[model samples]
Target: MNKNNLIYIFIICFTLISCGKNRIKLISENSNLILPKDFKILQNETQSTGIADFEINIMLQFDENNFQKIIHQVDSLILVDPNWKSSNNEYYYENFTNQSEPSNIKIYKHNKTLKFVFNHI
Candidate 1:
């Protein structure tokens, strides 16, 4: 193909691949989650009482369905902890559910942390 044709094709392919809807769909399907408006992510490292030497932090907004599902599956979830002290951990959900307004939820671990801001509206 000519140089111009090749450039046009590349642009078209890039545009198609960069479509926002596909990204949104992938995130939603993979996490069974829906993010709130103006959400953001932050990362950090820290020590924990578990198996891992250090934890990775992931901060974002919360989706109610995903949050509930995660709470339910916490026991079965495989958390990456460097300390390896405990295999099972319990989370307090009543505080979350009883809130009159949605609140930010922070999950900490030896290897990872998740921060989720919940919006009631």
Candidate 2:
């Protein structure tokens, strides 16, 4: 291959690898979880204990609008009453009974941030 062709291939590989390292796949696949695209992801972690058991934790810096949107989407389904930790923060837990995809989700909100924990077993 010519020098130019090799340089182009190297650049493409580097770009894909760099982007993959930072990409969060669950955010796109999770239909039940809705988060604004503008927020900065502070943390994203996933653990798999078995073939069909996994847990995902994500924390983001969001705005008031995003926070309200999440609350509204899950309002009617929150299984556990929200526990207010402080004037500016609270937590919500929701459990799904669908046998095909039994799972639980926890949401916590502080002034301008939200943390989501999702588990499927």
Q: Residue by residue across 1-121, what tens digits does model 1's lDDT show?
A: 8999999999998876665334334333333334445433453223353553322233543355554555545434324322112224323211234243333333444323345332332
User: Pairing residues by index, what is the TM-score of model 2?
Assistant: 0.48
Candidate 2, residue 61: CA error in Å? 2.2
User: What shift in Å separates residue 39 of candidate 1 from its native position after superposition?
Assistant: 8.3
Give the range where candidate 2 is weakest over 10 consecutive residues by summed lDDT.
Answer: 79-88
lDDT of 2 by residue, 27-116 (tens): 434434556667777877767869988776767776788778766665633443342122235644443544444333345664566555
Alpha-carbon deviation at 84 in model 1, angstroms? 8.9
- Supply candidate 2's per-residue lDDT for 84: 19
Give the local distance difference test score of model 2. 0.58
User: Residue 49 in candidate 1 has what lDDT?
Assistant: 32
